[model samples]
Target: MKLPILSQEIVITLQQLEGIGNKTILSKIGSIVCSSISTLDDLLSFWGNLKGKKFEAISNDDIKEANRIAKRIISRAVDENVGIITYYDEEYPEILRQCTDEKGKIDVPLILYYRGNLKALQIPGIAVIGTREPTPNGVKAGEYFSGEFAKQGFNIVSGLAVGCDTTGHVGALKVNGVTTAFLANGLDWESIYPKENLELAKRIVANNGLLLSEYPIGQSCGRYGLVARDRLQAGLSKATLVVQTGVTGGTMHAVNATIASKKPLFAVEYRNDVDISHEKVQGNIMLIREKGAIPLRSNGIDSAVAIIRGTDYKQVTVTQPSLFD
Candidate 1:
């Protein structure tokens, strides 16, 4: 499907307005003009109405700064060959558009900067997330599950972090399958986080995969941006799999977002005979025993595939003691 392209003016307007934190004001503006922003008159009319209203509280200085930033970002994107997709564009992932937060509010990005195959978003996807530091066993599990899923025509989606997220992308790539990395920073090569994944990001684009981000060019990753990026990881996927994680960290954030979005969640089940004190697998155990995520056996890739495909597959339940116990 050919994605709908937004006009340069509309893209600039959305990018400028993205810094607004007040949802009420942003929503009001979006409702009035998002659909008609292609018309310069409508955009100007909205800007004209911004004065003396709650939106005006943003200040002209802020607006000017935002516009200036938007122009720079656009110039950088063009020079770097990055693609921009707005919420108003049909190219934006529909799954992401349906994602909601704990409050049942639609949680989605207003603008996305991506490098590589935009068609990757059109495929069925499963997000694989876990701790940054994975055990040897955790690495094996991530590779096994992600590779199996990729072979079944599922696009592996991940944060492109170290450990399990990187393993997930590598596993998919090993099968010459499509994988999309959603970064917490900009899509520019200079902005790629974890520096180690720079080569992997290149391989993704070269192999027809995708690298996506909501941040504009030159913006570095922040604590809140990483937290916010988790939702997009979950939102873009048909389901989210926690290969291995500790109780705390970004993996758990993705877990919460997945559940809040009402998407199916699968966590790898550790061997009963093995030591459960392993920190990497602790989050997986907690998710299954406490949060009701389905326990997926390492060899049960078929069942995992079925869950994402919405097929009726045999369900496996784990009765392990809760970590909190």
Candidate 2:
């Protein structure tokens, strides 16, 4: 009756197997919460004792192929200075542990492939998300709000996409504050999505911040991966702030995940000032009106950030120069 808590290499190797992916592991998670199983040998030993065999083991050929692929990934990970952390790892982020679907199943990937400081994952973070094509004012809100959060010692979390995501990362960096950029693709420079932000990605890691992803090295960005990327942005944060979003886009995925988790979902009040015909602010309005999301004021401390900042000591804001106007 042992649980399978594996090492970095074992977890990464399991991820390559179609039959033993995160979902499969999570389905049996309740049984493996303790220390009875801690390694590949322990797992195999436990598997041999199963009377009815609740889990399915992969074929020998599949195991060999997975190991071969994992070896290459391990080499690339070392060459790129990338680090791997398993769900059972002591350093794994607790905030990300709350990422689950409607069925209450664990939604986080069993293995997190990251760069920069892993310690940042433990820091309280605020996710800043919005459309890839934000209005001029939308970008301003992203930068202003994110920079303000950074000053308060909260890690700025955002998908390292263009538009609001770019502004979110830039805003935090301007103040020399910590920011964690979650990518839809590999953390490697060549495989980083949106070649335009490749330098920005490097800058984040250089500033002692963090660049994170669930995808392994050599994996390119895909459409569904971006949607999946949104979930992690919301799941890893204390709250999620929508700088701007249309009726439908990748930002909504984060918004939905935040609400599903019953965390503080905040949308910028910029939607109120904009014209009704504005598409970008439409989703913002919907979130405030229909989704019970707290409205965030652009000018000063709105009700939401007030809850985030609390009665803790306050500090003057440090605004960052915009990277893209």
Candidate 3:
């Protein structure tokens, strides 16, 4: 499953270039690197054609720094047993290749660093996302729906954040189901965000799940990175479920990305008896009322399962007696 050694080196070098991480810039570079060039021997001709072009303006110093960084990245990846999948690699996920933004711009990452089963990406899955802080009801909903989906053979996809996301992964693992965690930082343990999820991440890998990232080794998580990571979570799934969320947060970003990508979105609906004024469930209401997201009955795993299976089911508002009820 290894790429040609030379191709791997060249791809890593391109990733190390400053400003190449930008999707538009990376797309342009990818066209050249994946098309006219296949190895380091072709880099000269590729560089010569765009010496003064705006997108191809890499200085000599930039090349030197890129070489150094690429070497370090390669060394670290090996030391950590992290797997690298470039855009041109055959192992790259096909679903990711079709992802785009609201404006129809391609939003796929140029490379991915992963640990554990790459095969898990090929399985049917749904992204489960929600607020970092969730009400007890929201946590139960996440666990119930995700665990139900896992039992039905759907891999759970989510960002490794706290609250609902953590519960989602735990639910899947409870049933010995596969799950994939899309990280906002590098795959290295030193950069795993929240620090608390380090054990959770390990459990995922141990349970045949995947820990994936677009950043290279040593990169730290940042606001923009987390925002960007949301797209991959949506892109990787057949559908996205918002267990609970406030109007503003990473969960909303994932919802927007799912809509932009034209994936099916299901938002949990709290029963009328429950307090709807809670900020945690505001985003779910907004999504259902404003964004046309299908309303998922509270604690109704069958409704979610039917949708994924493409069977006819009532989309009418459903309800759960309580969070765990």
**Residue-by-residue lDDT tens digits, candidate 2, 206-230:** 9989988888888899997888778
lDDT of 1 by residue, 126-166 (tens): 99999888877778778888888999998999988999999
Model 2 TM = 0.86
Identify the runs in model 2 with alpha carbons over 4 angstroms from their true place.
1-4, 33-47, 50-57, 102-105, 271-276, 309-325
By lDDT, the best candidate is 3
Q: RMSD, each candidate, Å? A: 4.2, 4.9, 3.3
lDDT (tens digit, per residue) of candidate 3 on 267-314: 878864453778988998899999978877645677667776775444
Off by over 4 Å in 1: 1-8, 14-19, 22-26, 39-42, 50-52, 56-68, 102-104, 272-275, 312-325
Q: Candidate 1 lDDT (Cα, whole model)?
A: 0.78
lDDT of each: 0.78, 0.77, 0.80
Ranking according to TM-score, highest score first: 3, 1, 2
Steric overlap count per candidate: 0, 1, 1
Give the distance in Å from residue 104's predicted Cα in candidate 3 to where it truly belongs.
4.5
Clash list (residue pairs), candidate 1 = none
